[model samples]
Target: MDRIILHCDLNAFYASVECLYRPDVAHLPVAVGGDEQMRHGIVLAKNEKAKAFGIATGEPLWKAREKCPGLVILPPHSRRYLHFSQLARNIYQRYTNRIEPFGIDEAWLDITEKGMDMAAGRHVADDIRGAVQRELGVTVSVGVSFNKVFAKLGSDFKKPNGTTVIARPDVSRLVWPLPGERLLFVGRSAKNVLHKVGLFTIRDIAHASPRVLKGCLGKAGENLWRYANGLDDSPVAMVDETDPIKGLGNSITTARNLTRQEEIRFVFAHLAQSVSKRLRKQGLVGSTLQIYVRFSDLSHLEHQGQLPAPTQLEDDLTREAWRLFQGVRVQKPIRALGIRLTQLQSVEEAAQLSLLWNEKKRQQTAQLEQCLDQIHRRFGPESVRKAPGLDENLVSLVRSTGVASLPGRPHAF
Candidate 1:
């Protein structure tokens, strides 16, 4: 039996969410962005209206404005985006646990265990697409297929709100005519090599001999060939599954350039707490702490230090992160900051506290943060805030955007 998979993608995710909340930008060309004066002014995401004006994400806001004079740019809201991402995930859970997130706005669902066929997969996709629109006031495009790669391509086949299906028999008719570069994992260098190999379309690559592709592009070529011919068999990971990863991290591009140590501390407190929350949620702890600093001019440096012990406490992570920050004698005023923890171990096998640090204090901090976690889980994430996070602008900036990638957890909306 063939596997049934669907790739669901939220349409204009960041901008769409903003529109639902901010009535002021209704029917206007909108884009989410950072402070232009702070050198973080690129368009992070744009709505369909803005896209029609040739406004591209990651391009400077000034350039985008030139394309559309009436472009209404708004500051990014990180916490809100995370909230909506969670809401969408909640809806997806009703169908299957075999949901694998690609990013904030895209995920792949495997419903083979439900005994779904290609037709039923499309039905499921349409159901999800409708649920997201009616329930969340946001639209989604779904691509139904037998594998991840083709499903992803199918999602991109249409926009805003769409559903496209590419079954095994339809591969040549629906997918083969596209450019070879459009295939998953095919980047610039790979495209050039494929062109040199006289493979310009998915059909060209699909029909090419494995030896020819391997001789040209190595393992990547082989992978591309497999994807083109519908040979991709990667599983859609369970939503709640935690694979043993190298590390976990969170970072933020501040709303404004941080000039003083107090400003830096404010952001660090929020980040450490956020990272610790995720670590504890996954029942893991880290033995090494790393600090990342991006300066006003975008030049940056990173440094890592050993923790007193593997810890999932906010205070401990904050202490080590601050220590690492102090050790780096940077002359430039910072534009953004990040914290990461590595050399992790499951809480069950975590080692004893290092003698250099007070064991009683460590235990106390751990206990305190754990209580806060329960409070957060019960009330809401923002129910509690550190006193140091009182700086109004800094607090707003921290809440605006969080570049976080952590273990997935199961939860209800």
Candidate 2:
């Protein structure tokens, strides 16, 4: 039996969610982004109207304005987006258990086990799109196909609220004519390389020799060849069998450059607490802490330190992250700071605490953070914060700059 897969992508997720809440700007060209005063002003997401004006995601907010002056900007509410993402997944649950999330706003569902054919898959896609629109006040573009690659391509073919299906034998006719960049994982650099070699279209990739593609781009080039040829057989990971998260991280672009240890400490406190909360929630601990610093000029640096033992305590994370930060020699003012914990192990897998660090204090801090987590879960994230995080200036910077990625947990809106 042939596989039936469907990829669903939320349309302008951030902008759409903003519109749902702010009806006044619902019809205008809207964007969801960071505060420019913080030097973090970038268009994270743009509405269809904004897209029509040639304003793309990741463009600086000032440039987006230059492109379209009337663009309505809304501050992102991370919590709300998380809520809606989960709600959308709940909707997907109605159709099949073989659902795999691509990101917060996209997922792939395999309905083949349900004994469905392409026609049935199309019906399921339409049903899901309608349900999402009616219930969540957002639309989804779905791609239905025999493989993951083509299904993802189909989803991107249409926009906002539409569905496209590509059958097994129809791939050459439907997908080949498109640009090579449209193929999954084909970024600008790869496209440029392919272009230099006269492989300008998907059809070019489909017809190219695997040896030449591999010789030029190595594994990546070879993988793209297979994807372009409709040979993707990667399975939709079962929810229960999904891989464990390798890291927990959070980064923010400060309103102003941080040059003082005190200023850096203030920011690290918030980031450490945030990362620790997620680690505790996931019942994991990390033995390595990494700090990423991006300068005002856009250049970046990273430093990593080993912990005496696996820990999820905010105090441990804050101390180690601060230590790592102190070790780095900054030649420029730092514009952003990131805290990441890798080399993760389940809390249950952790060994006894080493004598290098105070065991009693570790236990106490762990308990304290656990209690705070409960309070935050019951009330709101802002209900409890570390004492050092009380600086209003630092608080505003952290809030305005916004989070880079919230791995397992949905960040607070």
lDDT of each model, Cα atoms only?
A: 0.84, 0.86
| Model 2 spans with C-alpha error above 4 angstroms | 113-115, 188-200, 207-218, 239-243, 258-270, 280-283, 287-334, 352-413
Question: How many residue pairs clash (N, CA or C atoms closer than 3 angstroms) in each of the candidate models, in the order given?
Answer: 1, 3
lDDT of 2 by residue, 287-403 (tens): 988888888766677788899888888888889998887788888988888888988998776744443257677778888888988998999878876666677776776774566
- Give the TM-score comparing model 2 with the true structure, all chains together: 0.77
| TM, every model | 0.67, 0.77
* Model 1 ranges off by over 4 Å: 113-115, 215-217, 244-246, 250-413
**Candidate 1 minimal-lDDT segment of 10 residues:** 404-413
lDDT of 1 by residue, 1-413 (tens): 98988899999999999999997885999999877765568898999999999998877788999999999988888788889998999999999999998778889999886566888988888999999999999899999999999999999988989999999899989999999988977876779888887899999999999989999988877988899999999999998899676687887777777888878887888888888889988988888887888887656777899986678888888888888888888788787788888888887777444332566877787788899999989998778766766557767766645554433332100
Highest TM-score: give the candidate number. Answer: 2
Best by lDDT: 2
